[model samples]
Target: MSGDAVQIPDDRAFINFKNECNSEEGWNSNCNKSGITIWIQILRRGESIA
Candidate 1:
């Protein structure tokens, strides 16, 4: 997501609803594969979102 802001999506379902899409390339577990969930944070100038 190389833009002003990228939607990290509510889940992997939105970006990949394709039934035949692969696991890493797509959400093959119906968004149920739990792990380290990384999220995007939006910050203004001089803001810390880490």
Candidate 2:
């Protein structure tokens, strides 16, 4: 599988998608581990992401 590289957000954030994860999944698995249901764009750094 291949396509245009996902541009690092304007903040020069680091993006990681192991086994191909969407933003929602990435956020749930990393940032917001609570049961709350909300959506937000999170720009993570290399050290911030798992």
lDDT of 2 at 11: 31
Per-residue lDDT over 1-50 for candidate 1, one digit per residue giving the tens place of the 0 to 100 score: 66687656565666565533333432223333357444334457997733
Query: What does candidate 2's lDDT look like per residue over 1-40, in tens digits?
Result: 7987886554324344433444455453334456755555
Which residue runs does candidate 1 get wrong by more than 4 Å?
Answer: 1-38
- Best of the candidates, TM-score: 1
TM-scores of all predicted structures: 0.20, 0.17
Pick out the ten consecutive residues of candidate 2 with the lowest summed lDDT.
11-20
Q: Report the Cα lDDT for residue 48, model 2.
A: 56
Q: Which parts of model 2 have CA positions greater than 4 angstroms off?
A: 12-50
**Candidate 1 worst ten-residue window by lDDT:** 24-33
